[model samples]
Structures are given as structure tokens and as C-alpha cells.
Target: MQSSSSYPEAVEQLIAGFRRLPGVGARTAERLALAVLRWTPEELHDFGLLLATLPERVGECRVCGNLAEDDLCPVCRDPARDQSIICVVENADQVPVIERSGGHRGLYHVLGGRIVPLDGIGPEDLRIGELRARLDSGEVRELVLATGSDIEGEATATYLARELRRPGLAITRIATGIPVGADLAFADSATLATALNSRRPVG
Candidate 1:
């Protein structure tokens, strides 16, 4: 498995590590390993430092649960944004996709993940409690469930809709047929905007 002429063990270990990443096969991992080996000493050191410090440098926002360097994410802290409306998403990765659409001016709540019974993920495993707390604050007027159209996403939406139902609060689910199970990160801005604009009431 050692393809490198020099430091075979180190190169193979690096390749194996890369291979563990999603969508990265052995061939791609080998190529990445070779690329790293070819980098200058300073470049390699910088890259290593970035990887090592990334976790410590970035953390989830306490309010919205999005990746942030400070207590609150930019979206949550933005005064111009409509705090009365909250868009609920499955993860931080989906935030940029909805932002790119420029259709939503409300705040956001990241669930961290969806409900997947098969994978042993339940409503309690997500940020459902925090969402309920936010809803109880009486500040939010509408909760847009922007979760994916997949089974797990749907289940999560249903759970939230049922749990959060109350007077003076509007619960809506994003329009469907956006290539079910597809990650919102890959959806085009236009499509995402349309979906948000056409969201339907749930529960």
C-alpha cells in the first residue's frame, strides 16, 4: 500500500486517513497524500496548524447553534434581521444555502441533525428543547421548518410542528419536491428561494 518512494509509512498513513473521509476513495486519498508530501515544509506546517486549531477556533453558537467564533452567530446578532421569524434547519451546513437565496430575512435555529429512528437519532437528540424555549419567549411570530424533504427531515418537522403548536405562533414547512433527500447546500439559490416563498402551513 506504500506508493511513495520516500517515507512510505507516513504517506500510507496519510492516505488511509484521507480515505476515511466521505466521498473520498482510495485513489483520491492517495492523490491527496501525494499532494501533501509534495508541499514545502512551511506549507505543510501551516496546513497542519490550521487543521489542529480548527476545532478550538470554531464553536457552535449558544443561541442558534450555528458555527461561530463568539457567543452568538452573525445571523443571530444581526439587528437588521427579523427576529420575529425563525427558520429551522437541520444543520449549520444548510444555512449558507438558504442565505444565498436572499429570500429569508429572519433568524435561524440549527437542529444539529434530523430525526432518524433507524440511526437511533430522536427528537431529544436534536435542539428541540432550545427551539421550544425560544418559541415560549413570545418573540417569534413564525417558524419556518426548512428541513430537507427526506424521511428523517420530514419526521423531525412533524415532531417540531406538534411540539411547538400554540396560539399566536405560525408553523410552516418548506415547499417540497426539491429533489428529496438532497442536501440543501447543493440547491441553487433560485430553487431555494422558491421553496421558501412557497412554504406551506404544517400542523
Candidate 2:
């Protein structure tokens, strides 16, 4: 059978590449390919080099599980940040969302994902062990649970709140701003800020 596309093989290949990325549909992929085609050879070379080196340059933060170029993430290296409080989030993506809000000056811990029983993911599948190790160091006084408002997120938060209870630790949950069933990855900075600022003690 003959192929359906009329475009050159290279252009089709570029569009396919863009389509592999999350949320890039056929139209968007075409637009991206066209845009890339307009770039100078030197610009294209630079872009290719960046993509080639991305894997070597980026790795998970040793302390917080956020993406990092070195052994620790930028937040872990900053001594000025509040060391006594740690905001726990569901994923590294949510770290930036909360950061953009300019709320919660404390450091963060990325759980990697929430607990979903139906999906067969439990607390053991996440970074809960690493979190426990951090808490054991005796520096953190408060833990701000910033997981999503969804069911799985709620289960994970509740699990952590129950498991991590101990002397002098004040565990708090983000308050009313984020709507139920909403993912922190898609939440606006303003809403995140409100949620963080209004955090209440978790029972």
C-alpha cells in the first residue's frame, strides 16, 4: 500500500518527533516542525546538542528528588531557605508550581507520586522512606503536605500524616484554594499561593 502523506520524508519525521511529546497533537506537531525548519543550521545544531546532553546534565536531586544538574537540587544548596519546614509534594513538577506561587519559603520533598490502591501503588512505591530519613535528622519541625486534591493524593497525604507523627513535628495540609480532584501540576500560581498560605494542621 502507498503512504498517505505528501510532505517530504524529513518533514514527516520531524512532525512525528514533535508528536511524541506530551499534548502535542498533529496540528501542533506540524507547527513545531515548520518552526524548526525556519531555524538556522547553527541554531538547529545548538538545539540538537542541548537535547543530546540533557540526559547527562539532569538527574534527580539526592535530597529532595527534584531534577538537578549536580548531586543536590538548587533548593537543597540554598542555605538561606528555612530548614525547619519541608513542603511535601506529589511530584517534581509540583515543586515548580509551588515555587512560582512564592509561598512556602521552606524546602521540599517530591514523593514521585501518590498512593493509589486500584493502580497498585502504595506508600512503599514512593519516596516515603527517603522522607522518613530526612525527618529522622531532627531538623524539620513542620511538614506541609501539598499533594493534589484528588483521591489518590488525599490517601497519600493521610498516610503520611498518620505514619510520620512524632514529637515536635507539626504536620499541616494545604487549605481550601485548590479544588477537589485538581492536579497541582495544572494549578495556577495564585491558587497555590493561597493554599500554601492557608494551610491547616492535619489531624
Residue 6 in model 2: lDDT: 75
Pick the TM-score winner.
Answer: 2
lDDT for every model? 0.88, 0.88
Q: Which stretches of model 2 miss by more than 4 angstroms?
A: 1-4, 179-182
Taking the tens digit of each residue's C-alpha lDDT, what string does model 1 give over 1-203? 54544556777789889989989987899889888888999999999999999998899999999989889998988999998999999889888888999979999999988888898988889998999999889999999998889887888889889989999999999998555544678888998899999999999
Q: How large is the C-alpha RMSD of every model relative to the true structure?
A: 2.3, 2.3
Model 2, C-alpha of 87: deviation from truth (Å): 0.6
Candidate 2 local Cα displacement, residue 145, angstroms? 0.3
Clash list (residue pairs), candidate 2: none
> How many pairs collide in each candidate, listed in order?
0, 0
* Residue 140 C-alpha lDDT in model 2: 97
